[model samples]
Target: MTKTFETYSNIQSQNIRFRNRFGIEVAGDLYLPVGYETQKNPAIVVSGPFGAVKEQVSGLYAQEFAKNGFVALAFDPSFTGESGGAVRNVAEPVMFTEDYSAAVDYFGTLPYVDRERIGAQAICGLSGMALTAAGADTRIKAVATTSMYDMSKSMYLGYRNGYTDEQRAKLREHVSQQRWVDVDNGASETGHYSSGYHELGFNADGCIVTGESLFPEKLPEDADPVSKAFFDYYCTPRGYHERSINSTAAWTATTPMSFYEFPLCHNIKDISPRPVLFVTGENAHSRYHSEEAYEAANEPKELLIVPNADHVDLYDQKDKIPFDKLVAFFTENLK
Candidate 1:
């Protein structure tokens, strides 16, 4: 516990667990504002970057938000990190969407929390989940997302809209067939193409070895920039976590099977009367997602583009992330 506190000396926090709607125990670290629970303060819940655990960028944001006077909670999504669930490291969109609302449920019971003034924030793939939750759950009064990516879009349409209808049809066929093949397999099913990255370690020259070395000494220049950036963060001390699926395991084999059916961007306008702040890097590959979400939303919304930044930059690049904007947005709307 002391060791954990040493990692982030800027704030005070406590480990907590709460039961979700499914009665699963969700683990989190709640950052309390200075002076220790003296007031019923506005609170924020944070999560993100898809398979990332709370110990990484989410915790960074939570601790910073706490320093700025709002109590903040960062939790692992179900089936990931310390959160309780059957299978491990899988992305179930519906259940992941529910995790935010469940965090709200936990906040309501905290003596230091002003439940009426609650907000939520996320980054990358989880950003779309945060927006979807805020749209459906009125309890969330404001939503903020950085470096947003629509996971469903990534699954069905492929990165940057590169996949064709014919390719998608083949993908659907592949997933449907796997469902039958997995009936008796129990988390060990096959036929997934999450290939290319297998092993993770460090070489003699301190170069991070990710997978079977598609390139011997350096990453291929033609590799997807966003993925390369993710590797830079999760493969080094910048934001690595042993429990994070991004750091320790390859993308889930069944990721496409569950994610293709759930499009989180469908009802972006539903959260009106409630405010939203969408933040994305100017150079982010997923910036289009935040742009489309902002356009679809009703009034009382904002799209903040950080100059000279990329998708993963907002994850742990504290200097690059507009935390001031976040503090101001939550303060104004969560009042």
Candidate 2:
């Protein structure tokens, strides 16, 4: 018979604070299982979906991991959520990767954590960040990602539909101008300019309607259905949060500037020997990301498709999350 681990009867949660290498204070929700003991238990660091705060998906993952006998934390990255940074709603590729490394550092110091057994899981854009971390930091023993987004590719080439070279150049020019404006103003600036929607001219009373004009015209045939799934996730209340970057206006115009230049998969082969798990929905709009990353990663890797699931379905859909597999993956590897 399989051993039945007792559910945590009185889990304790608290707002915890830690700092990155850059001295930026990172805030996170720390969950502790009931009857927890300081036996140096294995721990997992969870973050991302990018532009999302710990209060959302990351917190949920942390809580689930804690329930299964692990020390887990979900943190807000610098410049977003409750974390410290001068400009808000900005995304920095380097600093974001540093944030993951910082989490590993914090986990290493905790009295109740088995420092050597630290693992990480990043979702969405943060999955790319996790891959960056796994390659650079040997401290991370095992890594996993769900619904991964190759931010670099998405920034330069658009989504799965891809972008024209002319369109990409125009985007670069737009970001460059925004950088100059911010430098001159000496303060963060915000306002909508020419986004992918404006290029298509599908304005419908201030909202960019996503019908024939937007999706069918610009998106690839294979991506139309997937884009619909992404639309449901971002536009609906199902996973929408006031703090989600997707639910808000485009990030500070200059945010994409750095993303366009940074190639995220440079050292992917370094993660070899250490197992990597890529999880994506079978019908997810972003399944290609996991597939590409899995293909590029070296030996000791896995690609898992949640059957019949869509891209957003893996987010907070308890029935489709494959918790048993996740638990077994981490438990077996962390040992």
| RMSD each, Å | 5.9, 6.5
lDDT of 1: 0.79
lDDT tens per residue, model 2, 296-320: 9998999999998887777678889
**Candidate achieving the largest TM-score:** 1
- Tens digit of per-residue lDDT, candidate 1, span 273-319: 89999999999888888888899899889999999998888887778
True-structure RMSD for candidate 2: 6.5
TM-score of each: 0.87, 0.84
Clashing pairs counted in every model: 1, 0
Clashing pairs in 1: 198-211
